[model samples]
Target chain A: GIQVEQSPPDLILQEGANSTLRCNFSDSVNNLQWFHQNPWGQLINLFYIPSGTKQNGRLSATTVATERYSLLYISSSQTTDSGVYFCAVVNGNKLVFGAGTILRVKS
Target chain B: GEEVAQTPKHLVRGEGQKAKLYCAPIKGHSYVFWYQQVLKNEFKFLISFQNENVFDETGMPKERFSAKCLPNSPCSLEIQATKLEDSAVYFCASSPQTGGTGNTIYFGEGSWLTVV
Candidate 1:
């Protein structure tokens, strides 16, 4: 099994601030995904970047597969962005998730 | 847009009772997975099926947790003699197929179970 670790386990910022979250995997992975669990407990897919970079709205993610690491960038944070961010990677047949980074945005 | 549908948004049961959760994967998806998240914490992989066939269940409890996927029907995850620790939000997800170099999966809203 592969071990996934997330950094800055907890983060807090003002609405207009910016932040970056990181994920590191112990082994090679075929699939990688970023998820946002909202206040209501709904898990929303943020990105499916196995490699390279992707952007959606104010959020962006970059995966360096060779380095076995990924970075998620949140710009101009908003109150709606307050939640837990999870980074998961496929290890063999099942996906293993990280401990997650809890982010809070103050209005 | 594709989505996984989970039934019974919330469930409450006794410690010794049985709890069953259902998930309907998106059309044409062949891989279904079940994961349990306790109090918005770490995700514990339970089981997965590749079109009615168990693909990998290494993380499953094996004794008290069982799951099944049938043709044209929703997949079901059943917990027998559930314990207080079994209370969590169960998430279901589906991908187009297995063994692909890059596969993107879609997850359901999740079913929250409360065991007293």
Candidate 2:
């Protein structure tokens, strides 16, 4: 039962602003993922970076496995990105998720 | 393309009634998972299947919850005698690897179950 904690439970920013969200896990993990739960409640896969850096459009993520931490960076945020950002890790057969960081981007 | 599909975006049932939800994993995926997201709580794993076989169901409430993955059909999770606490968003996810880093798990728009 590894614990995953997300920082800054809530975040608010204006459109076009950049922000960083962090996730810290308490144990080793075989896989790490960042998901965006949009307003429609769709969990969109953003990245599957277990121990490296990955970038996709305005979103990027980096996982430092040794340190048991991961960071997600969003640049030029849009209203569409206003929702919950979750980070999940695999602890054996099951994947555990954090409570998630609630992001609100105002236009 | 890499997305899981769930049916009946919303479900409402009376207390003590049975609630069933269906999930269709992405094509070629071998692993399917079911999770419950209660209010103010993180997603909790309920069960997982590896091609019709129950891989791990330790998280499932053995009392009144049951799940099945029929051959060539969408997997289903049924909750018998549903209660108010069972009212939450149920999410289904699928991945190519059972538990590997290549594990790009994709989830569907969860099915919200409201039991009154």
Best-fitting candidate, scored by lDDT? 1
Give residue B79's error in model 1 in angstroms: 0.8
CA lDDT of each candidate?
0.93, 0.91
- Candidate 1: chain B TM-score against the reference chain B: 0.95
Candidate 1 lDDT over A1-107, as tens digits, reads 79999999999999999999999999999999999999999999999999999999999999999999999999999999999999999978778899999999999
**Which residue pairs does candidate 2 place in steric collision?**
none
Docking outcome class, model 1: medium
Kindly report the TM-score of the first chain in candidate 1. Answer: 0.98
Residue-wise lDDT of candidate 2 within B57-95, one digit each (tens)?
A: 999999999999989899999999999999999999888
True contacts kept of each: 0.73, 0.71
* Model 2 lDDT tens row, A20-105: 99999999999999999888777888999999999999999999999999999999999999999999999887789999999999
lDDT of 1 at A81: 96
Model 1 misplaced regions, further than 4 Å: B99-101
Minimal lDDT window, size 10, model 2 chain B: B97-106
